[model samples]
Target: MIKWVAAFLGYFIFRFPGAVLGFIVGSLFDNMGGSNGGGRNVFQDLTRQSVSPADFELNLLSLCSIVIKADGQVSQRELDYVRQYFLSTYGKEKANAIFRTFNDVIKKREVSAQRICSYLVQRTRYEVRLQLLHFLFGIAQADGQVSKAEVIKLRELAGYLRVGQHDFESIMAMFIKSADNAYKILEIEKTVSDDEVKKAYRTMAKKYHPDRVVTENEAIKKGAEEKFKEVQKAYEIIQKERGIS
Candidate 1:
């Protein structure tokens, strides 16, 4: 449908050749599951590669730089946390190469969160973006606390990435401990009945399940596993609090 519409528009604006080119480009978008795909089935098949591994690392580095500098004072611990994470995820050599680029070039400039996040929104799945947010929160918490400034920047990035408010708050609650953090993690209100709470837990568990994150990268899979555990932990806390068996 998108290809046909684009072809028609192109033909109207230009000629036969324009329609051909428009259709070719539209097919690419369709295969990769464009913005309308809602971030599902991204890179599901080995033959269809939406974004390259290099591009993923670079964009991720860009986001890291944005969050690291958000609090006005760049802490070494935060920097090391980013470095160590990438190092552990991608082997030593690739991670070192990425950080080299990051230190010399990417980190020195003002990264446009809107542009980077927009690209991510189109290319990556929602589950992948959730892990990206989780990683950023880890960076913010690396220095012992998540500052107000960092939270503001993270929320802005999340909005730009088109992540829903409930999902954003759920990840945020995982790091920022509070009396009702469990409820927030479950994306439900404390006023809801036990049955509703159970339902929400089941929903979140399925949503954040490690298997839902389809990737060959062990680090990404592990991150999803950690997220799944957090959901389970939130349910446990709620169960204990409400005395639900």
Candidate 2:
């Protein structure tokens, strides 16, 4: 559509009357499309102002593939995480289109790490990119462990995003640790007596109570909720195992 419009405008721009007619026709076309103008001139102006949706979608898929392949082997769990994330963020149809683009890139083996990193740096804002890194880290840890390959890839991505090493390590540590595992997260042992389990849960619950953290900072509330949930899950697992519940 843009190409044809540009060609028509180019051919019609030579004569005074033709130029005037072309300008009016181009304005009409732009208004119809809700664009500032029609043809190459309009496109150049738009390009200078913002990133294109196609570029955003391509970058998103490339980042997903990079994180999924980080574990040396991509497991069903990881793939499911990606699929679920896409479904949540985008509708199923759009997610499928994005997935197809990702597969195409993999099949061709034509995409380079440098190219992807460059595009991400140029196109994404800092907070968004950081959140994306956290999402990747969460996906990597979803199966109860993080592989060395996954950690390396995460660091590589951190480098690309220009996230400081200290900040990356801090966030990575939070995810890699089994926040979902009650016993591990609370530092309780499987062999701990029923009373000990209850005591640990009480202690950890007090520390992670969402209200307490929410007062400190809104962001800390999320961490607090995760920790509190872990405490509950751990207590339940232990109680069930010991036949207390």
Candidate 3:
């Protein structure tokens, strides 16, 4: 549909900037669908700003393959995690089919996380990329603990994805809980005062707030909600320990 419109516009309009604008707007309209009776969608203005939803899912799955292979061997639990993610995000029938085909492609390809992630970071939004890292961490910790090699690779991947050190550590804290892990979850130092902890909690709570993705698709919005909940849990844990209301 977008291609048809672009082609027609290119043939008829046959102008430089006009044709280009037509192409871009056509693409956005295709993504927005006819749901609005030609009314404005909140995402229409930003549709061409990033990859389409399908491409986003593909990029996420491709990167996940590299993360799953980080420890040199894939475990049943790890595979199950991927399946479960698909099952929940997609549905049972589609998830099983996608898992089968996705497994085949990843099995045949030898992908480097850095190489692919470098490309993704340029085009993908920060929140979407963070969700990919979130999924990767979930997969790595599926069996119990994240391996040393996995952590190294995940950290490297985080770097390639342009995820900030504090954000990466905060996500990591969700999966790996140590004695002082709560501080990491809040992206604060342990030496900070009670007031500082409260402040950090407020800052993180705003940073990971699900409402930030409210304009996104349902699945992506749900991922943000999960992140928001993790932040809340960490804050609650610290609040209980510090005897703060």
Candidate 4:
């Protein structure tokens, strides 16, 4: 408990303080009753990654239900996409139980997309949230192309998550391969010179770099690596299109 408090002691102001920091501090403290050792504590402190970050798995599924339902139709493809995401992330034992929870949450009107996004944004770090957006897009694009409704809902969800405009746009660009999307992924103007395009790609390389994520969770770190690879692919596509070496 003292370690948890000391871990975030600087964040607590005279007032209650901000949401993200407050959420992390409170969640860490609250989770203490359930489960560690001094060496484990020191290890976890260095990693800044918990096995389950702020009870995120259920929240992920809840938000996913909102995403796949945007088109007013939930296909088998969409259902399976959610299943695979959970299965791959948490394995069969937990995935089966979590899917049931997802169904229950979807049936209730008590949770809104905004509320789900806000709750997650408050608790987890940015890279994890970025992956949440990534999964949402993956589900939306499962049927090949994203529908207008899904796009609007995704943008709104990103707003709620407080994802930066450029970052959100970059991710959107990656999923939309048409419409000079490579340049969009790099966040460069269509008319930008090759040098400018290279600069943008380098900037994104730094942003999505796996080591930059600073998470102890190997799973989360792998997600970051995948995202970075997406950025690399986008840059390569742009170069191919522009005939740039």
Candidate 5:
């Protein structure tokens, strides 16, 4: 799709060589994750030259560091949350090793949310990306309250990661309490009709279904389960408010 379009535009301007070059560039975009087969399961292409396990761990740590430092004062609770989360996911030895590398190297560098998340946005599945945001929000809220600066940084990271605003808000509402948190969690407005509320509940239930994320990592699946439960709880709250069965 993109390849052919670029080739046509190139030929319209510079003819043969330009067409060749354009096709090459477009192929790269297509291979990286373009409109073609947009519905394809991301896990199906695990063997592709995507980010390795080590790089994934390191990049995750970098993002955590960014969030921890966002408020201009590092909280030990946030750090412990990250460390314990990693320990539970990767076991004690591996988690300690990762933290060592993160402190010694990844933390010292000026991490670019755009650069790191751009790579992940292309390679990781949408569900995986949502889980990433959920995890980051967990870090921000670890100290009992999420700071204004931390929310700003998390929102920036979500934008770079190409997560939709509604999805980001939905995940955020889970951690941050608000009067209309239920509606936000369900990704709907309060003015919607009763039928629309039910419809939205169904949609969100499927979207945040734990089984939707097919990964070997139980921690990732557990994160999805948390989202699933949040969605369910939101629907239940809406049901009670509206007197729906």
Candidate 6:
């Protein structure tokens, strides 16, 4: 009966913080010959080791570094976006540590892509991994443009993340659609009609333009096409509504 009670307690400890800490504590008690033998000692050790930093943080930082470097140049906008996301997702204290770790990895200048991808694969959950990829896409579009280099890097990361090509293409489409919608919301136009459109275009263009969102990239021209279309549409809509045309 005493042995049964001790074994039950051991099982309860293993369930929460897991087998690693359980194993250690259990072993100490086992060494003292207190209870149900050492049935879970091995399991506890295994669980504890499994919770190491290699399981999560390392891989997260590796992926984040790769993402920030997706564009040929890392702009202030990209940095700011990354910082904001980290703060929101991890809270300020942890976010600062994460940013520091990510910056350190990126600054190494000698890290291999395979090494980075391997870390990401080992540490991150699939959904969180996808979110990181989307964040990179956002940074690429932040500058109101996407460069060929940035696109290629994004594609490479997608592949490395094991996300399907179709999904990647879908994400690109979404970015284009968002830029288009933003233009419409601002009521800007392709051509100047009164100083209002010109001013509105300048302001709206600045706001939704990819360059302002990240650093400028030539590849973003394709995404910009949608923005242009939206501007044209808004101009038409406004003109018709206000009897300007």
lDDT of 2: 0.62
Ten residues in a row with the worst lDDT in model 5? 38-47
Query: In terms of lDDT, which candidate is stronger, 2 or 4?
Result: 4
Who is ahead in TM-score, 2 or 6? 2
Ranking of candidates on lDDT, top first = 1, 5, 3, 4, 2, 6
Candidate 3's residue-wise lDDT over 1-245, tens digit each?
A: 88567856775776666667777878877866743332222222223254554555566677778778888887889889988877876689878877886687568557666767876776657876677788789899998889998999899999998999999999998888799888898999888899999999889888778776646456566767888888888878888988988
TM-score of 1: 0.79
Cα lDDT of candidate 5 equals 0.82
Model 6, position 1: C-alpha lDDT score: 37
Model 5 bad stretches (over 4 Å): 1-49, 105-109
lDDT string, candidate 1, 44-157, tens digits:
222223556667667778888899999898899998998898677666987788789878543476688999988888876666677788989999999999999999999999
lDDT accuracy of residue 148 in candidate 3: 90
Worst ten in a row by lDDT for model 2 = 39-48
Model 4 lDDT per residue over 150-191, tens place:
999999999998888888888988787677777778777899
Candidate 2, residue 230: the lDDT equals: 56
Where's the lowest-lDDT run of ten residues in candidate 6? Answer: 40-49
Q: Can you give the TM-score per candidate against the true fold?
A: 0.79, 0.52, 0.75, 0.74, 0.79, 0.47
Write candidate 5's Cα lDDT for 1-245 as tens digits: 88899998888899999899889988988886643332222222232345566667767788988998899877889889988987776679877987887676434747888998987887777767877889899999999999899999999999998899999999999999899999999999999999999999899999888777755666767777899999999999999999998
lDDT of each: 0.82, 0.62, 0.76, 0.74, 0.82, 0.56
Q: Superposing every Cα of model 4 onto the true structure, what RMSD results? A: 8.0
In model 4, which regions exceed 4 Å deviation? Answer: 1-54, 215-219, 243-245
Q: Which of the two candidates, 1 or 3, achieves a greater lDDT against the reference?
A: 1
How many pairs of residues collide in each model? Answer: 0, 0, 0, 0, 0, 18
